[model samples]
Target chain A: MSLGGDWYLALAAIVFSIGAFGLLVRRNIIVMFMCVELMLNAANLTFVTFSRMLNDIGGQSLVFFVLVVAAAEVVVGLGIIVAVHRRRAGATADDLHILKG
Target chain B: MTHLVGPLVATTFVDALTFTVAAAIVLAGAVGVVVARNPVHSALMLVMTLFGVAVLFVEQQADFLAAVQVIVYAGAIIVLFLFVIMLLGVDRREVFGRENLRGQRPMAAILVVLGLAGIFLLGFGAHWATGAPSVAGRANAAGPNVAKLGTSVFTTYLLPFEATAALLVIAVVGAVVLVRRTPGARGPDDQDDAGLEEHPGADGGDGTLAFGTGGEASGDADDGDGGERGDLGHDDPALGSTHERKMTS
Candidate 1:
């Protein structure tokens, strides 16, 4: 098939679905965090593809900010994981039900 | 060879080949990420996916983005993931198909199918976005895309750009504070208990004498141990130099 903006956007969508699936099904919080990252990447790809198709500078510039946001998110999210793991031996999502009644 | 009349055709062929390879790598890596039982393996798969996306970016002529993708996403973000994986010791094989919540798998499956179908519809079923014939910039074809990106960022989008820098600094400092373990921060009781778990071999080696005479071999080894030892060593019935030497701190 010809590689077009539509093709790349479709790939992004599929990848995003896979990430969301993993996020929902997996109990391991670390893996869930990985899934979140994957979703972010998929979004980034879509942004670049749309930018290329539109011939606009704005989409690509937006991608630069997205990268920074992703980096910051990684730092914070993994830090939370470390903190949770320190208190509890396991990082299972099941163990994080302390707030529940 | 020097007078070849097919330079443009050669580039198109090369682009098609690269796209095929990169797309395959990305899809395979995405599958690997979900299917892999071990989180560490999943992390490696994520690296593969990130690399493939970088290739895709380069193909789109986003040279600076391709570099940033590899450097930031693969280099830093995924490295942080691996660190958490190793530190947390969550690398053990995940119990497959085990759902802590009822209907979680079914829900996820339905959501996945819906999501994919909707996205496909957005792409094909509808004539979707109003993408023009082609971008005027064409990235490097017009001028250096990065230079163009810099000029816009500093001009039109300066406020958000500065805000992002501030956001990153806060994230860095906050993460450091959250993960750091300062001495005497936690009480002696929890500290000693955590110490026992920290050194499993020490717990097993020091075994019965570590906890209680009636302590089970592996039971005391796994549970919150080092309590009796802490009491004996710190302020209780002085158990002599041997017990004191055994203390972690």
Candidate 2:
């Protein structure tokens, strides 16, 4: 038998927590984006684990959709990053305060 | 074959060992992604995490997703990230010791720890699998993993699948629009125009700056562009008005 679902779930939780912490603390927008990817990966791992636990193909299907969405998100996000970098070289999340009212 | 064993049976030594190793790789890569000073190193660390997740997927009999995780994530996505890092030349080591916001790191650490504890409690406190089994279809049914996944996606989740296609097309178009630069209309005060002459289309012209047409179009429509332009805008109202005047005339 394979390891229990709880073990995988616990690992995923830790990874997700780390991703969230990195997202909150990191100032570099690209690194921040990577952290988001890490969180999404953790969620994907959970879905796959639950798919095994529940014997349902739906969880995996949902993960497939998530993969698509993540690809889209990354593309647009990086495009925006490139555009921003074009205007202002080496600007970090901390440097972005133009929207402050 | 191994999955056929009932969950009640104790896990084999090999299974435990594999899980232990993969989980270690995953956690180490995750921490590396967070702590790496250079963005390039962070991207490489992300690849390690993705590979570890892929191994876990295979362990869970998600064979197709394991392959997809490797191909799409490790192959395409991380490469794209690296390309951007190299292209933008932002791979320089960042000073991690400096804290722009006081107490931000400590607060984030506390919040993440509390949230993680809550998730663990909630996950383990009750019966983890409360829902009916195989409501969609049996994942471990006798067939190839790809076939089962494809059948489910095409049959039960067809609408969502189609929507994802649309989403992908929109993303491609949005990316192109965002990165496209308008020729002529270089800002005289803009200091970073040193390399602008390299692009064949970017002929130097009047001092009027062609602010991102992507930003302007998004600002006008207020669609998904607001989120992309969250950090972008002319801070000075006078410069903004001048941009507007230049655009109109």
Candidate 3:
């Protein structure tokens, strides 16, 4: 038998926390996006864990959809980042104040 | 001691060892992603974490997910991230010592710690998996992992599967539209127009059209400027008048 489900859940929680911390603290938009990926991966791990624990294929199916959404999000997000970089050469997340009215 | 530890540890030694090693790798990579000053290093660390997760997926009998995780997350996603990083030339090391907002780092750390503690408490204290077992299908049913997953996707979750296909198409189109450079399009900073006009040769004479860089001159030659007067003839008349004034003075 594999290890208890709680072990995987605890690990996922910790990884998610680390990702959240990085998202909040990091200034660079790219690093922040990486943090979002980390969080999503952690959630994926949790889903797989529950899939095994419950003997349900639905959890894994949800993970598949999540993977698709993540890919779409990354594509659009990186395109936006490229557009932003073109406008201001070295602009960080803090420097994006064009919408401030 | 045997009775207390028996339920927690895996019955097989290999199972326990694999979980221990992969969990360690995942945690270490996650921390590295957060701490690495360079975005490239963070992306590499994310790959490591993804690989470790894939290993765990295999261990949990999620063989199809394991392969997809490796191929999609580590392969395509990380390469795209590195590509963007290199293309934008933002791979330089970031200064982590300086904090722009006062007490923001500490506050974020504290919030994450509290949230983690809450998750742990809620998870262990309550019954975690309280649901009807195998609502869609049994994961442990006697079949190959891929076949089982494919059957479920095509039968039970067909609508969502089709929706994801549409989502992917939309994402592709959206990315192209966002990154595409339009001629005479003004950004928030209007100063780039002056810079491009002054140094037309710097951008190879077509700087005003192609993203203000003049890297390529293949598409949309209708507004392509042949000389100084052509430079002022932008699609936007207001912008054209502004360029005319700048050229005259």
Q: Pick the candidate with the highest DockQ.
A: 3
TM-score of chain A for each candidate? Answer: 0.94, 0.96, 0.97
- C-alpha DockQ of every model: 0.47, 0.51, 0.54
Clashes of 2: 0
- Clashing residue pairs in candidate 3 are none
Give native contacts recovered, as a fraction, per prediction: 0.53, 0.74, 0.74
Misplaced by over 4 Å in model 2 are B1-9, B184-249
Candidate 3, which CAPRI tier? medium
- By TM-score, highest first, what's the ranking? 3, 2, 1
- DockQ-derived CAPRI band for the predicted complex in model 1: acceptable
Q: Positional deviation of A14 in candidate 3, in angstroms?
A: 0.7
Q: Give DockQ: model 2.
A: 0.51
Across B136-187, the per-residue lDDT of candidate 3 in tens digits comes to 7998999998888898898999999999999999999999999886666875
Counted clashes in each candidate structure = 1, 0, 0
User: Which 10 residues in a row give candidate 1 chain B its minimum summed lDDT?
Assistant: B212-221
Q: Write the per-residue lDDT of candidate 1 for residues B161-197, one digit (tens) a residue.
A: 9999899999999999997766546533355433423
